[model samples]
Target: MHRSAETSLEDQAVDIRIQMIQLGWDTLTSVPKSRAGERSVTLDEATTRVLQEWRTRQNKERLAAGPDWNESGLVFTHPDGTGLRPSWVSEEFARIAARAGLPPIRLHDLRHGAASLSLAAGVDVKVVSAELGHSTTAFTQDTYQSVFPRVAREAAEATAGLLSGDAARQA
Candidate 1:
């Protein structure tokens, strides 16, 4: 069985290419003008599963709607096939988080969380920056430095250990 780098399932390879921005209730746009925001992101297994489930539900909804289904080709949308407003997404996130007993946070905080968690999980900052559509690794480092102090210390210690071990071998 062939497994993709992002997903272990042979048939579950997902390629992300676009982000959706809704300008109004009826207006949706793709292809961010900024090149940084146009990059693709690899999803983890849980995320892929969630997306797969959502896709299946969406397909069923589309079948039910029949001719009424709007062919938007968006990753996320309202049940009736309309694009979701940014405000609606933020409000829904807060509602769900609150229901789950999570502390209050803006939807954008999830982006920061993703970056910091990835870095702490040993993903290179360069790769994280690219996935986040940041123009440069330094910008990512500077922005997330405060969020990953422990990670920074651990990295420093690891580097020191490597150097000390090398010196011991030479002696």
Candidate 2:
């Protein structure tokens, strides 16, 4: 089960408890699209520190808003603590990416990049699949994981070394 954002932040993790979707004129909070989507993602040290700073800033915003604060209990929110629209967030991301001179990419492409990087870094496919909330490793591999040229070359070299008994000698 997912804990409150406050509690999860203390643990340096973000629990995927709910999803917020904008439907035409209304915004709705609902369960995730799949069972696997309701999982926890642990943060690295830098990310945890950044979130801690953001939380402190958010608290100040809440105090400034006083009675006007919405208390949505979400990690990301507007100055008055209301949820941001998903479409707006995507548009903002695109603008930010463009300002950085990055090639055009949808915000969702970050997930694919993360998955590919994890696989290239030698993380187990099952673990990467779980992190991505993928139903199966095969789907994760087929859709997100790419054989980075460096990683493929390393695998080829390792296989050749093993066949020539050079791997044992190196070990």
Candidate 3:
């Protein structure tokens, strides 16, 4: 549920960079920049390890930048004192996607991806809405119906899953 990198770091320029810290990627709460804004974005164990390493590096950077820190208290930073701008980062995204030969996509797709992935994992739509900071569960259901239709259709498919016999015929 990443926002523009700026939104992720809550800054103006993204200098602190993905390189700056070991982002303690554990947990699913770090849905940074979810509709609610910068917050936990629970990550997996592997991500946690990477973030831990990045954390070490961030401290190193802090020491290196002593006296010149912005002190925004954010996990991500701008290298120089201050934060990043969401717009610049979002534009770079499109250029990068085009260069990679992938379909051009808005950065918001990551938000969509989060909802989709959660649904595929059988998580409840309400949970996803809260995670994304949506105002209501219906918004989550409407937004990710592609991933959530199964829940809606579960009853209809119950008999269909039955193998052969009268059940299959009824389905």
Candidate 4:
């Protein structure tokens, strides 16, 4: 989701309005790839507080930049308020992850992880699919859902428990 520079901190939701795509040397902002991509994502309280602090810091940078500030209306930007290139973000994420001793993972892997984790945490698939901007829950389940061993075992146990309860009730 893209946050506008003018977005009020009072609201903890960001609308997914625009997408930035890189072509050659230029980065262009345009409508999202699909209609489903246009949605709102609500921030948790902790994330909302962090963004509030980041905005304060960014405002200070904007003041320091003076006439040089680009006014790009992005939540994250360079000191001069210009947007960062997507490729640069991905490469930097890799470097940071390596420095933190994490297993080598592409930045996009986080999306898959979020989907899988959300499912494992018992969040509804439809809600997770919507957050991911997937057109359909079937596609989301087919593509992003990974059945972890523990989650699989928990599911089996829960089903057996339900069956046991049914037998007891009948008796």
Candidate 5:
């Protein structure tokens, strides 16, 4: 989600924009692969509030930094306001996980977990794919189908019910 849109949503709508990222030496660039990667996602209320609070905190830090701030305007940034290095982010995640006594997991794995959660919550596959910046819905389905077996089974059963003229009424 871009910072401006996130802070401006008075009705609690959230938009995710996968427009830029730190890929190798290039710190930021347009969507990585295709147009599908650039999209807006609606966030649940809890996530929206968390982001709003995070922005507020960031603003406080910006004020404290004053002239020292780099003003990169990224949601995640270094203490001096520059973009955070990807490796540093991963290492910090590992350190925090260890401190919390949690099992080890790569930072990237969180993206997969988010996809699974969205699918399990009955969000449409295409929407999840877009939010994940997937090149195609097929890839999203193929990758995540195994993680959301129950939802997939329910989908199959719903299709069967449709054939039996029952799903329409349920819908």
Candidate 6:
């Protein structure tokens, strides 16, 4: 519930929306390191539900604050019910990342990380690309190629039984 005083109203509102939706709002709103994320990775269904619930809660707050609850269209609204700005959202993303001891990567790195993590988990590249909002499969593959080695290594480890597993078990 504690917020920085310097925090802009715009960001505060956005934070509220994110909180309400329970989505990885910070991840979805920020641009991605890869071009694909800038294009896609919108709030998933579960997060969408959180947003809907927050929206209802916000509506009640609006009604309590004023009679113009009907005009409150956006999920995140100011005390007077205005839309949140983009810069504020970005600033907060940076602040949170810094606090978390994360590397000083762009806010969008989450998209790439998500892709890398998914690929590592054996999710298909096509799915990763789509989730990352990649325009072409090749681009997705190119950007995430670094993951292939790890992917291969993980696969080998997971199926160690082919050779290593057999030898180890016999011993």
Which candidate number has the best lDDT? Answer: 4
**What are the lDDT figures for the candidates, one per model?**
0.71, 0.83, 0.59, 0.86, 0.72, 0.57
Q: Model 4, range 46-99, lDDT digits (tens) per residue?
A: 988998898899999999999999988898899999999988888899999999
Residue-pair clashes per candidate: 0, 0, 24, 0, 1, 4
Q: Residue 66's C-alpha lDDT in candidate 4?
A: 100
- Which ten contiguous residues of candidate 4 have the minimum total lDDT? 1-10
* Candidates ranked, most accurate by TM-score first: 2, 4, 1, 5, 3, 6
Give Cα distance to truth, residue 42, candidate 3, Å: 3.1
Give candidate 3 regions above 4 Å deviation. Answer: 1-41, 147-159, 166-171
How far out, in Å, is residue 60 in model 1? Answer: 0.6
True-vs-predicted CA distance for residue 157, candidate 2, Å: 1.5
Candidate 6 per-residue C-alpha lDDT over 1-171 given as tens digits, one digit per residue, 9 for 90 to 100: 212221233222222112111144331332234554343234556666676676577767777878654453554566556545545656788889899998787756776777777777877888777765677878877787465677788778767755685777876
The residue-by-residue lDDT of candidate 3 on 1-171, one tens digit each, is 122333322222222112221234322223333344333444556665665575567667778889997765555456753544445557888899999998979988978887888877878777777666676788888887573566558845774568658766876
Model 6 TM-score is: 0.56
In model 2, the runs with Cα more than 4 Å from the true position are 1-7, 165-171
Model 2 Cα RMSD, Å? 2.7
Is candidate 5 or 6 superior in TM-score?
5
> Can you give the TM-score per candidate against the true fold?
0.75, 0.90, 0.61, 0.89, 0.71, 0.56
Candidate 5: where is the Cα deviation over 4 Å? 1-30, 147-171
Summarize candidate 5's per-residue lDDT along 36-60 as a digit string, tens digits: 6555566677877887787788788
Q: Model 2 scores what on Cα lDDT? A: 0.83
Ranking by lDDT: 4, 2, 5, 1, 3, 6
Model 6 residue 165 CA deviation (Å) reads 9.0
lDDT of 2 by residue, 1-171 (tens): 222453466787787878778798687788989999888787788988987897899899999999999987877888998888888888999999999999999998998998899899989999998888888999999998788899999999878888786667767
Clashing pairs in 5: 16-41
lDDT string, candidate 1, 23-140, tens digits: 6565444565668866556766787788778778978888989999987665576777766677788899999999999999999998888888888787899899988888889999
**Which of the two, 2 or 6, has more lDDT?**
2
